[model samples]
Target: MDSTRKYTAEAPPLQEVQQTRGPLVLEFGTSWCGHCRAAQPYINEAFTSGPDLPHHKIEDGKGRPLGRAFRVKQWPTLIFLRDGEEVERLVRPADSASITRAMARIEQN
Candidate 1:
């Protein structure tokens, strides 16, 4: 899958993602969000290092099922998972290091 691709529809069930093999990154935010846009470069840089990692960019807003399930309260929330289990999360990461650190958690698992 395209690491930079953004999903506009509702995200898959958290349980489904959790059950999926390998590492995954669930990114919650809207395309129009300034915070999300600002963090794109860092996010890209981190994920680019692991081209095989699945990065799901889900558009989040009020009443969105997946976002609600994850209890997302901020824009650009990155949830790292391995074997469908949450490994780490970063909200509004300030730099590539922060994103890289989160990605490392998944790699280490």
Candidate 2:
């Protein structure tokens, strides 16, 4: 969808994510987290620039109720959701290849 912009969990009801008929990858991150910051560009580059997947970013902080609901414990956690349910998730990218591969998999489904 080319949503190069970030999204908040509070933006809307999440049930639609699963019912939309395509895949959605939610990124949980915090601003100061080096791993999270490092992964952002890779996500954009991989999805928006390359495969063109519908990507969304959520910040783990007091204002982000959705992050709290997801129980995000670390930075740059990639969660693959299809039909509003979690299908796959990677806590942290071991390397660039793995990160892009994760997104690629999400794009595939």
Candidate 3:
């Protein structure tokens, strides 16, 4: 797990993301989004004790192909993927339990 958490504006292409192996989490949101900001604590807490998987905080907005490819409509959408296929998802998570639960699902696979 990454100790430094921040959303990166430049994200990999949709095709490249789909080709990833093993479990990973994709978090989509802008830096200034309130809902995205509010969810950070929960996200952080989950990662703190959760499995050491690749977690990417991608800055998403207009013209972002990766977000659109995943059909993300809400900020801070956490997509749990195993072998590049989605297993579970959490949107605007309010608690670490929910995020942990979602991570568990993918970790199980």
Candidate 4:
């Protein structure tokens, strides 16, 4: 997956994406968010280190169903899941290390 990719305004249902096989990273953020843009490099680096992992950037804002389901209250919320179950979450990560650490959890499971 391309780490620098932009999220769409509409996304596949959260439950549907969760049902997908293997490890998945669901990133909730808006394109106009500064925090989201700032974290892009770190997010990209983490994904670069784990290329096989599936990463979905879902545009999130007020009333977005997926974000609401996850109870997202901030930009750049990265939810890590394994086998359709949430394993970890990082909100507005300050560095690549944080993201890498989260990825490690997914890798271990």
User: Candidate 2, residues 24-106: lDDT per residue as tens digits?
Assistant: 77777766778876666666666654555666777667656666667777877888776567777878665556656766666
Model 3 ranges off by over 4 Å: none
Which residue pairs clash within candidate 4?
Answer: none
In order, the Cα lDDT scores of the candidates are 0.84, 0.66, 0.89, 0.88
TM-score of 2: 0.70
Tell me, by TM-score, which candidate is best: 3
The candidate that wins on lDDT is 3
Where model 4 places Cα greater than 4 Å from the true spot, the runs are none
Can you give the lDDT of residue 59 in candidate 4?
A: 94
Compared with the true structure, what per-residue lDDT tens digits does model 3 show for residues 19-86?
A: 99889899999889999989888888889988888988899998888999999999989999999999
TM-score of 4: 0.92
How accurate locally is residue 33 in candidate 4, as Cα lDDT from 0 to 100? 94
RMSD of each: 1.6, 2.9, 1.1, 1.2
For model 4, what is the alpha-carbon lDDT of residue 55? 84
> Model 2: how large is the Cα RMSD against the reference?
2.9
- CA shift of 94, model 1, Å: 1.1
Query: Order of all candidates by TM-score, from best down to worst?
Result: 3, 4, 1, 2
Per residue, candidate 4 scores C-alpha lDDT tens digits across 5-100 of 788887789779778777889999989999999999999988888646878899998889989999999989999988888999999999999888
lDDT of 1 at 67: 88
